[model samples]
Every structure is written in structure tokens, then in C-alpha cells.
Target: MPRTNLNDILIFMAVVDAGSFIAGGEALGLSRSAAGKAVIRLEDRLGARLLNRTTRTLSLTDEGRVFYDRGLQILASVDEAEASVAGQSGMPRGILRLTAPDAFGRLVILPLLEEYLRAWPDIQVEMSFTDRVADIVEEGFDLAIRIGATASDTRLVSRAIAAYRTRLCATPSYLAERGEPRDIADLAAHDCLIFASRTRRHGWRFRGKGSSWIKAQGRSRLRLDSGEAIRDAALAGLGIALLPDFLVADDLAAGRLRHVLPDLETDDAKIIMLYPDKHLLEPRIHRFVDLMVEALGRERPDARSSP
Candidate 1:
């Protein structure tokens, strides 16, 4: 077997992504002929036809699609290796890609971007906000902020960024009209707004002084996937909402929403950060993780708040 090198895979991935030898050549600073030769060399070494090319366009063969996918992984590993060595200089630079939930990103991370970008001028960040779990490594994201149980994948590393608790809250007027539930069983009589993503199948969970928890069943009048909408619904007296404490800190203080089951306790959900594990930690990823931790910590309840 001919020992394939990083350049071959890089050129292969570029061509696969760009859809033509000319575009790949332009991207990699090689001539169109050179890029074409590189792909041929890769296919020859692998004993497989990687692409079907015509004068107009290039398309991957069945084997080509499989190889293209693997080649992308190889190129990413090479990039991470190079970045790790470069990161030893004690400065983070270049593009840092991240993904997170939409509402969480907008309400939480977006607010910290100004300070984060100013603090690290060399680091350019591209953030994608979505509710779906992203393929961080395959899609080329440096990090992801996920709110629920971290799925076990050997390709990625996970870390807990912070712990967050859920609140069963409603507008003061709504609570007055619906009447506050004194026990877990009473939740069945009130209308509950369920967060489509995090709520348990059984019901809402509550936490108390010693971290004791009690899950309760409720009738969901409105079911929403977005945290912001659920919060808004609660504010409008639509229903009792099981919301994250971070999402409604202002509302609780301003008397817009009142807590219902302070006496009953539930399990606290975790906020986590995830990244690919195959390569060494680069400066950009390290710096971004540090920045995220600092930002979340600064917003903790004990931290000084606006007076």
C-alpha cells in the first residue's frame, strides 16, 4: 500500500467540497491539473475510484462518497494537530466555531460576545444556534453548549459548565386565579407549560435545601421547544411554566412571575460543553472554554448583580 499523506486527503476534501478541480486548486493554491492529479493519486493509492468527473462538474462515486467522508475526518485531525502545537505560544487566534441552543445562545451567550471578542481580538468566532444536537466533529464545530444528558460518544469530550435548576412559575395574577399548588399532587389541577426539550416523561422536577427532588404530573396547556417562548407564556398568564432559573431571574425579582412549589424539590439539570477528543486541545478552544466558564460564573447568584 502506498503510504498516503495529509496533503492528498486535504486536496481530496477540498475538491469534494468545492465540486471541481479548478475551485479546489484555487482554494489550495495549486493549478487545476495539479488538483486533478492529486485526486487521481489518492484514488490510485486506495485502489478505488473516488470521483466521476466531466468537463462540466465532478460528482462522487459510491466509494468516493465514503472516502470523502473519511478524508474530511483525516484533514480535521491534521488541522487540530497543527493548531495544538501553535497554541503553545499562549495566544488563541483564528476561527473558532461553536453551536448551542437558540434561546440559550441569544439570551445567554450573545450578551457576552462583546466582552469576549474584545478580550481576545485575534480569535474570530462563528456561532450557530439550533435546538438539534449537532455533529460537532463531522460538521467542524470547535465546541457545543448542550443542556441535557450528554450522549456518550468516543469521538468527543464533555465537561459540565454549570448546574441549573428549574422553576415552576406563573404570573402573580395567574397564580392568584389558578391558586398555588401546595403539594406535588396538586399540580394535576393546574395548567403547565412544558419545555419540549428538557421536561421528563413523568412530569416536572423540583429541588429543595438538601437537593431533595419530587417529580409531579401536570396537564400541559402549551408545549414549546423554546425556553424564551415558555417564559413569555408564563409572563402572559398562559400557564404555569417549568423554566430554568437563569431564564427568569429578572421576572422573579420584578414580581412578574411567582414561584409555586418552593417546598417540593427536584433534580437540577446540567449545562455542559462538548468538543472533539481525537486531537490535542488548541489555544482557540482552550481560550473559548475559559471565556465561557468565566461568563457563566460571573452570572451566578452569588456574583454581584445590578443594583
Candidate 2:
């Protein structure tokens, strides 16, 4: 094998991680042509095609996968070494890529990020706000903030930053027109604005008469993927919606929306931050997550539902 260039290896890794030569090149301050040529040079040196690339998508071949894994190991080792040397003055100074649920990210995460950016003058942030779950490793995200989500990935670390409660709510007009649902069974008569995806299912869990948890779903005619859309539908008198208190707290207080079953306890909405497993944490990720914990790690009195 020819002597490998460290820069070429890094460019190759970036292209693979980004799933595009253009994006990878942009990250390294290189042109797309330069990035493509570098990867080609790397493959020639190794005497094998590493990437299975089409016009629309780029994927790693079997050899590329093995090589990428080894690259990650090397990068981890380098990161550890750098952290030890800069332990005292280790300030976060990079573009931190984060993914979060849209409504929560806008209402909550964005504020915390504002403070983070102001505090760390050198750090830049890129945020992706969507309801869709992003693969932390495959997508190369530094962190992800998820609401009421549970993860089963061993390569990631999940931490609970805060907790909230869900509220079944509707406008006064809707309540007047359809009449209030007296019990869970009566919910079948009312229009329920459901937040769910095409693949995943959703059910509203409540504490019934015996203080036992029971799962029930109202009749859902309007189903939407966005939490804000669900809230909007409820406000428009379209249906009753089960939503996190954070999204409905303001409306509930302003009397625009009334809590439907305030006495029936609902499941806790957990706010979790997820990140890749690493021996030494990146300063940018650690700082941002710490800020989120500090900002949201408290009981919200205003969000409490009243019957």
C-alpha cells in the first residue's frame, strides 16, 4: 500500500458521512470536484472501489464499511489525545449538528441554543427540526433532542433532561357543539385529532377510576404528523387533541383551549437528549446538553391542568 495521506483519509470519511461529495467538500472547505478527486485517489491507493455511488445517493461498499470503522477508531483515539492536552482550555469551537422534534425545538430547544451560542462565542450550531427520527450515527448528528421517546440503540447514550405531562384539550366551541366526553368511552363520539405517523401508532393513556393506567384512543378522523398542526386543529374546533402541556399551556391558561379530562392523569412526557457514545465527550455537545438540562430541569407549575 502507498503511504496514506491523513487529509485524504479525512476527506474520504467526510464524503461517506455526509452521503454526498458536495456536502463533504463544503465541510472541509474544498470544492466538490476536489472532494471527488481526493476520494478517487484514496481508492486508487487502496486498490479497490470504496463507495457505491449513484447520481442520487452514495453508499459505502463492504471494504469501505470496514475502513470507515477503522477510521472512527483512529478518530476517537485522536480526540482522546487532544482532550487530554487541552483539558484546561477545552472550549467548544465547532459546528454542532443537532436534531430535535419541531414544535419542541422551536418552543424550547431554540431558546437554550440561543443562550449557548451567546455564551460560547466560537461555537456555531446547525439545527434540524422535524418529527422524523434521525439516526445519530448514520446521519452524523452531534446530538438529538426527543420528546416522550424511548431508544434501544446501544451505541448511543440517552439522558432525561426534563419531564412534562400530556393534556387532552379542545376549544370551547368544539366542546359546546359535541358536548364534553364524560368518560373514556364517550371519547368515541368526539373527533380526536391524533398525532401519529404512517408507520407508528399512537394511543392516549390515562389513569382511570382505580388509579390504574388504561390505554384508550378516541375516534380519530384527522391525523397529522406535526404536533403544532394537531394543536391548531384543536384550536380551530376541529377535534380534541392529546398533546404535551408545553404546547398547550399558553392556550389552556388564556382560556382558548380547555383541558378535557384534567382529573384523569396522563402519561409523563419525557424530554430526552441523545448522543453518540464516546470515551471523552466533545466540548460542544457537552456544553449544549448541559445548558438544556439547566434550563429545563425544573417543575413547570403553569403547565399543571385544572379540572
> Each model's TM-score?
0.66, 0.71
Q: What is the C-alpha RMSD of each candidate to the true structure, in Å?
A: 7.4, 7.7
Candidate 1 structure quality by residue, lDDT tens digits, 40-75:
888888889998978798999999999876765564
Superposed on all Cα atoms, model 1 deviates from the true structure by an RMSD in Å of 7.4
**Lowest-lDDT window of 10 residues in candidate 2?**
298-307
- 149, model 2: CA deviation in Å? 3.0
Q: Name the regions of candidate 1 deviating beyond 4 angstroms.
A: 1-81, 87-90, 197-202, 207-212, 298-307
Worst 10 residues of 1 by lDDT: 298-307
| Local accuracy by lDDT, each model | 0.76, 0.83
What is the per-residue lDDT of model 2 for residues 10-33, given as tens digits with 9 covering 90 to 100?
Answer: 999999878899999998999999
Candidate 2, which segments miss by more than 4 Å at Cα? 1-81, 84-89, 298-307
